[model samples]
Target: MAADDNENWEDRPLIMPFCGQSCWLVYQTLERALGRSVIIEPGLSWTLVRRQDPNMEHLAKITKCNTMVVLAEKLIEESFDPIVDRHTRNNMIQSVVYNCGSNFPRTNFSRFYTAILENDGRVISAASLRIPSPEIAEIPFIATSEAWRRKGMCRKLLEAIESALGDIGIKRIVIPSSTEMLAKWQIKFGFVNVDYQTNKNIKELNTLMFLKTTRLQKVINPITRKTADLNFLPPSSPRLPPAPPSGQ
Candidate 1:
């Protein structure tokens, strides 16, 4: 969400999904107090992509970059906070409240995984999952420091995130890319472009991509009563099961 001061955001409202109801209410209250126009800015458009294959676990094992991938939940469990400053510097909180609300400890809904170089113990790359609904998870941020780019850190973090989600029965993931090259690069990792549109406010094209994991398939049974197969349907389709009842 951070941009150069010279760039104009067209005075649009910022649209970000919170990980918990409390954070959502807090943001809403803040917006009401400060006015939506002051809080939201429209500048960059991002492409959305998804992946569901646990087989992608191999990508998480890349050792050529001399870094190790670990779940942020584990770090929190051990009381690690050195990387908090790094996340702050990157403006991670402006995009989503991953560090607040129900995600404070570690829940299946909002989890952050990171990559760190062994030699210096410095975090090089990271990605977070925000489950807006039981049926969908969004990766709002997947960042690698400039010094770590082109070293497979981002890919490692991505693979780790997908593998972790698959382990817990998450079958869908959504990613937003800011550039065509980034969207194209994601295709190699199993994402497919499903929609494209031009954002008049940002003056950029936004591509939406998705992937259905093969691990868990909904099998509807007439007698047994099971969920229907509405994978290809839109999220709001009536046939799809209602979102998880939990606020998180």
Candidate 2:
């Protein structure tokens, strides 16, 4: 997606910058094009999960020989790349997107997203997804690490994911629900039972379809320059409803 001066970012990154075709390409565009995280609220910030090295140990645990403070060169400043060009910024942006296949949602799922609220400096919240076809995508979970339940963070996370999905031209999303939460998923979240077309695609879905889980899906409105303008309105500032019973 092209970056222009007139871009409205009130519900951004969540609304997805440069949202267009290809889910994987959408991920790449967000990292390189947007390259910034949104502070969702006073205390919460939204970002892709940070990627960490598998072999590295704790900072204090590293021996002086492999340490930072007393390193041979001026290591602290050396650690940061000089932002000389697009290459420098692009590399920096990639570090924020998590890539651990071993994590929740697992390796088979292609993309991982998170809704993080930093407290005293730490990141958290999560989701994982797989794109079975250009028109259909499957999501495994959305969760937060802190006691942020009922605070609308999950909605914000879903908005962000939906923004990207709609941007990439993915027409619908499928999520699995337990029988217990089916009502919440259907009524509260606006999901409905799978129809014939989605069910027809099941053979191609493989293990992406969870066993015994109630299937839920929501049709996405295709986002474009026109419709995207309304993408990320906050809860307090929703689009007005129609006037009713005017002559009753």
TM-score of 1: 0.36
Model 1 residue 228 distance off true place after TM-score fit, in angstroms: 30
Q: lDDT tens digits, residues 101-193, model 2? A: 433322223243333333333434445454555567666555554455576656666666666657656678888777787998788777899
Tens-digit lDDT string for candidate 1 (24-104): 332232222210011011321111111212335544323322122333333222332223323234323322323332433
> Considering every candidate listed, which one attains the maximal lDDT?
2
TM-score of each candidate structure, all chains considered together: 0.36, 0.52
For residue 37, give model 1's deviation from the true position in Å.
41
Q: List clashing residue pairs in candidate 2.
A: 20-168
Residue 35, model 2: Cα distance from true site in angstroms: 7.2
- If candidate 2 were superposed on the true structure by all CA atoms, what would the RMSD be? 17.2
What local lDDT score does residue 97 receive in model 2, on the 0 to 100 scale? 28
Which ranges of candidate 1 are over 4 A from the true structure?
A: 1-120, 195-248
